[model samples]
Target: MNRAAQAVVMFLLGGAVLRITWTDVYLRYVKQGLRPFLIAAGLLLVVAAAMTLVYEVRDIVRHRGHPAHDDGHGHGRSGQLVGWLLLLPALALLAITPPALGADTAARSGSALATVGESETAFSPLPPGDPVKLTLIEYGYRAVFDGGRTLRGRQVQLTGFIATGPDGRPILARIMLACCAADGIPIKIGLRGDVPDLAPDTWVRATGQWIPHTVKDPVNDSEIPYLEVAAWLKIDPPANQYD
Candidate 1:
């Protein structure tokens, strides 16, 4: 690819990065903590692209009357085509922002819960509240590792998209991201009691007590805990889908 083409591609990629990081769109792919780094990296790319274009233009002006000579590294039409193909990712980022991970991803992953290590068995007392809010991962840890000892006699609230269990029962689920969507793992809680039938990926806020009973995940044999939902309400998906 020519230097000009390379500069254009860099600019497009940098602009795409800045666009997503400037809004909540980035939260769908990465943790909130990484926003500043992404912004800095985008700015660097843009600056580098701008500098490159300036040098290319200066060189053209300096040699306007001279005969052109091919650089040893120059690739023919085939290489230019391949270089242009690299723009698709940048263009897609600019034109189409994909939706956050949802039930389909969770279901396809077999709804397996992440295993708690033996050294991580420590439990903390639930904070004082009528319906204590908890992430799906936190709820899972307490229910599976501690046997809901910290959850008994307390009504807890969990917010996540609904996913269907192996038995076709609705389960409350959220994607847990260690870094980004590529490394996301689904944490699911079985919904019992009088929970309403909801379609997969329907975001909801569930308030319930831990059922103290755990069922084995058919795919991985990881214990999936149950929630005796007292009440639930449909809600829009949160700004950040991962927990």
Candidate 2:
């Protein structure tokens, strides 16, 4: 693309990224830690846009008395093509802001193993209360590797979407990520005992007792756990979908 067009594209893309990051919009797509990176990237793009504009305007002034060419737009077909190509991503961002991954993503990658070499944790006791609230991923880790030792007999509540495994068995699943949606990993808690025939991606708060069962995670060659559902409260999707 010509310098001016390239600058505009970069500016738009960077501005959009900054806009999303500055607000909560970016939380749906990436880990919270990327905030500074998004800001830096956006600033760079805006600077580039300013520099390109200055340079192009100077060139035009230098040729102030020149005759116009037949392609009166002053841009070649190649430049237009490049500009359009660059526009695609910006346009996409403007058109549809993707919500965090839900049932569709869970079903697609249900069996993904979040492998960790044997690192045992000694968890502190749940705060002196029943129905301790837990992020779905923390519950999963405690359930599986810790042998459900901490969760036994305690009432716990977790919120996540209803998604099924490859075998079509339903689960309460949440996305776990180290950086962004691109690196998201699925953490699932198999649901048993009076689960409703709810649609996939239905958001709910599941209250349950952990009934520890030793089931092998075939993919990771490790043991995983399931929950004995006591109740399900249908709810709207949360502002944040990852744990």
Which candidate achieves the best lDDT against the true structure? 1
Q: How far in Å is the alpha carbon of 157 misplaced in model 1?
A: 0.6
Q: Over 4 Å off in model 2, which ranges? A: 66-76, 110-120, 217-222
Worst 10 residues of 2 by lDDT: 214-223
The 10 consecutive residues of candidate 1 with the worst lDDT sum are: 111-120
Tens-digit per-residue lDDT, 49-79, candidate 2: 9999999989989989998567566767776
Q: After aligning candidate 1 to the native by TM-score, how far in Å is the CA of 214 from where it should be?
A: 1.1
Q: Alpha-carbon error at 116 in model 1, in Å? A: 3.3
Best by TM-score: 1
lDDT, candidate 1, 1-243, per-residue tens = 889999999999999999999999999889999999999989998999999999999999999999998887856899899999989999998889899998887777755465757654759899997899998888998888887889999999999999988678899899888899998878889999868688899999999999868877776778789999999999999999998
TM-score of 1: 0.94
Candidate 1: pairs in clash: none
